[model samples]
Target chain A: MRHTLRETWTGLRRNLTMTIAVIVTMWVSLSLFGAALLANQQVDLVKGKWYDKIEVSVFLCVPNVEGGQCTSGDGATQAQKDNIRKVLEANPQVQEVYYESKHEAYEEYQRVYRDSPVKDVLTESTIQDSFRVKLSDPQQYLGVVEQAKSLPGVQAVLDLHPVLDPLFMWLNALKWGTLGMSVLLLVAAALQIGNTIRMAAFSRRRELGIMRLVGASNAYILTPFLLESLVAGLIGGLLASGTLALGVYFIIIRKAATSITTIMWIGWHQAFLAMAAVLVVSILLSVLPAFAATRRYLKV
Target chain B: MITFDNVTKIYEGQAKPALRGVNVDIDKGEFVFLVGQSGSGKSTFIRLILREYRPTKGIIYVAGKDLSTLHSWKVPALRRQIGTVFQDFRLLPGKTVYENVAFALQVIGRPTREIKKVVPETLDLVGLSGKGKRMPDELSGGEQQRVAVARAFVNRPKILIADEPTGNLDPATSVGIMKLLDRINRTGTTVIMATHDSTIVDQMRRRVIELDAGAVVRDQREGVYGTA
Candidate 1:
């Protein structure tokens, strides 16, 4: 064991430049991998926050609007409005149905268009009463919209999917792009580790030959090379973890979370999970390639 | 003791065999010399004993164990009982003479107390007692070869194989290495050496096995280098 340690130290020091190159490559690649994982988690968090609040707006018939369900034509009566509410409440997919009176809708319009010239043209008389329906599963919004469209005095059912789909598509693209880049770099890091092992084995060919002649077992001859790569991988893993922590603290928590207060951001728990993944990947990347390279070079 | 029974070795991609249907035996406590020109299979004979190459045709027995049937994992155990020295003094360049000698014992998992005791004794036997602190580069070619001999014999292996141990040394230096091998053989350790130095072989007057064209041309007790 002492001999193994001494030999490993000597091998690492002998190939100091290659060892450092391996560590640096592992660090950069693992950092990117961790970042990709965090990006995926952040996208999931954003989806959860937004999807929970998604609503389908069911607009009622207005007085002068020519609509199929508005045969009475004086506007939807209280009886028709109550009937629509009962039907929505009875649907299993609907979580909650909120009734917005004409006055409430007019107030919402005035606040939303406070700076627009259209606010002067819109009034309580022009505004239509609507029911904002929240569903247990946002994916079932189409069913709710179909059911409400067939109800009495309902003019139109508007789903939020079209308004929100483009934003989610952009987020999904960013997540996968980061993940793809990380995978490519990880492959490069594994190759670099293999090169480093091959060079170290070549440099110590004399020592290895002597060991083999002296009846050193295969494990005894291979342990030092494995340990050298293991040490480099450990250093790289630690550096990647540090990079992840700093990135999450500075970019996600400190900047993005503060600026975008409505969206939920990932916490340290998720960051730690990503860091663990980085460490596992780094160790596997370094040790497996090193083993293969050493085995190839150790052949007498 | 080592015995080769009708052993034939044909290397890959080669029409000619390196060794063919050769039969020889050297009992324990005997000093044997293998003499041949390059590619006459002297090296192949040495490699077969070391278990580095298996015979394509017949079986070999070393210390009464069948080498052909020896498990691959047990090769190290087989090698541990035999020490080897090569043409090049294959010492760790960064290590001292004492560490170089101790490395053999260390690889075989000998204890520190045992290594400390055995290394100096073997170095002394090889006439390198005071030079233990010196590095391989700091020593003369003869002294470096002495270090290699010390490492080979330090583990007290039953058999010692030397392939041109004195190939690079002057005659006077070569005689010194031969005397060291003679002393090692006197300790009842089987010593097999391959060399082209006829002067030393003629002077040593030990058992000689000569090979020509992958076949044994002569095997004589106390033989001279040439046909006599």
Candidate 2:
């Protein structure tokens, strides 16, 4: 091991620029992977910790105010509102409820469409009252949703998860995209390492030829080449570690955490674990290329 | 210690053989030269000893390991006991003369303390003790060649092959390099030098084997470099 280290140092010193190139390439690629994995896990983490905090929107019937029968898009009846509220209050899954009456709902509609023709259409008498139901357990949301939708006054029972489905889809795409890119680039990193070692071997072919002539073992010839790969990997790993730390510190913890204080954040635990994954991958990538290249190219 | 028995080497799909039906023997501690122009099989003899190519027919025995039967992995160990110096000096450009010499020991995984002691002694033997810190490019051609010699001789190898060690040097540098090989030979390390250098080949007058058209036409003790 000591012999391997020393030879690696020698080879690294001889080609510091290329060594740095290897490190940067691996670091950046792994960092992207790390960031994406952390982000995906961050999304899952948000669901785990804050999903319970999510609430349901129960659109109460407005007593046929528009003179239309109860439908998916129609206003709720006064009896529907009362029955939905009673059912929610009786259900153990319903933690709390906030009632937005027709006047307040109309006001909110006008506020939203203040600059548009929709403001003229939204009046206190024309608006629909709704019940916002907070759940004690996110998993039990389904029971409360079903019960509320069946109530005599309720028009709609909408869970927030479905509302945020598109967002999650985007996050999922980002997560797997990062993973895919990392895998592809890790292969590239391996190839680069192999090529670098091959070049080093070629440059030293004469010395290697002599070393073989003098009864040096195959491992003896392999020492320098293998060491070079590991050195490249280690340097790349360190760079990746640094980059990952910075990304989480600046983007996730400082920015994401602050923004997600009202929501959910995976924090630094997942960040470090992701970084560890990068380190392990870097080491493997380095060692594998060196081992394979030496075996294939150096017969002795 | 060495024998080439009717060895033939034909590179795959080649019109001519690199070496053809060659046979030679050298006892331990003997200094011999294989003199030839390019493509005359002087190099093929060295290559056969190095086991870079196996004989297409016949056998080569060096220290009782049949070249034809040797596994590729064990060839390096065979090479370590038989040091080789090249025309290009082949000192790693990035390293100092000391590191270049120490590489022989390093290659075999000699402990650090042993390396520190043996390296200086080896450098001194090659008359480059004070020049140990110099890089190959920093040293003169003759100095670099001496460094190569030190590296080759550092392990106290049983046999030393100097393949045109002075091929790139001037007459004075060539003589100096030749004298260093002579000094190592005096210490009972068998020396085999392959050269197209007529002057040193004539001057040394060791047992000479001459190759012409891939065949040994002359083998003489107390030999003279012939006009080819």
Candidate 3:
């Protein structure tokens, strides 16, 4: 064991440049892998936060709306509102139904636009009554929207999904793009590790020949090379973890947390998950190739 | 003990068999010299004993174990019982003479205490007692060969095979190496050397096994360099 360690240290020092190249490439690829992990976590965070709040707004008839939405003259009668509520409550996909009177809508507008210039222009009489329909799965908004679009006393079936879907699509695309890039970088890292180990094996062919003559087993011959790569990979994994911690510190905790207090960002648990992913990836990337490269040279 | 029974070796992509229907045996504590010209299959015979190459026909026995049927994973155990020295005096360049010798024991999982005791003793036996701290490049050609010999003998193997252990040395140095191998053989270790150095062969007056065109031309006790 002492000899193996000493030999591994000497080999690393002799091929210091190639060793550094492997570490650097491993760091870059692992950091990218961490980034992809973070993006996936962020996408989940966005989905969880937004999906819970997404509602189908069944806006009832207003005083001056056209197209006979109300059987009474100006607005939807109580009977029409009750009928619409009954139909929505019976749908299997609907989780809960909330009714907001015109006065409640006016009050929400007043609270939301308190500092805006339009606060004074909004009134209870100008607002429309609505039913906020929550679905068991926010992705099934189209079903409820189609069910209520032509209903009596229904002015419009407004799903907030249209406004948020594009944002989510963009986030999803970003995550997938990062994932694809990480996969490519991972392949590059694997190849670089293979080449580095191959070079180490080639340059130390004399030592290996001596080792073979001395009756060293194939595992004994391969341990030093495996140690070299493992050491390099560990260092790279730590660096990638540091990079991820730094990114989370500056981007999510410091910047996003301070700027956007409403949406829940991914926390340290996800960062730890990314770090763990990087650790596993770094080991697999280095050890697998090192094992393969040494196997070829150790063949009797 | 070593035995070669009708061993024939045909290397890949070559029409000629390196060795054909060869038969030889040496009991424990025997010192045998394998002498031949270039391309006379001397190296092939050494490699067969080391299990570095397999014979295409027949079987080889080392220390009473059939090598042809030895498990692949167990080949290291077979090799551990034998020591090999090459023409180049294949010492690790970066290691000192002591490290080169200790490496043999270390590879086989010998304890540090055992290595510390055995390495120096073997170095002393090979006439390199005080020069254990010297690296290969810092030593003379003969000294380097002594280190190689020390490494081979450090594990106290049952058989020691030298493939032209003096091929790169001066005549005086070759004589010193030959004396070292003779001393090692005196300790009850079988020594099989492949060489074209007929002068050393003539001086040693040991058993001589001569190969010509992949066949043993002569096997004589107390043989001289030539036809006698």
Q: Candidates' DockQ values? A: 0.54, 0.41, 0.55
Candidate 3: tens digits of C-alpha lDDT, residues A86-181: 999999999999898888888776654443456678578868888888999987888899988778998888776767678668767877777788
The residue ranges of model 2 lying beyond 4 angstroms of the native Cα positions read: A1-7, A10-14, A39-161, A184-188, A195-232, A238-265, A290-300, B91-100, B111-147, B165-183, B197-208, B215-228
For this target, which candidate reaches the highest lDDT against the unseen true structure? 1
- Which candidate number would show the highest DockQ if scored against the true structure? 3
Instruction: Order the candidates by DockQ, highest first.
Output: 3, 1, 2
Docking class of 1: medium
For each candidate, report what fraction of the true interface contacts it reproduces. Answer: 0.68, 0.79, 0.68
lDDT of each: 0.86, 0.79, 0.85
Best by TM-score: 1
Model 3, residue A89: distance off in Å is 10
- Local accuracy of candidate 3 as per-residue lDDT tens digits, B83-152: 8888898888888989989988888788999999898899889898899898899999999999999989
Interface RMSD of 2: 2.1
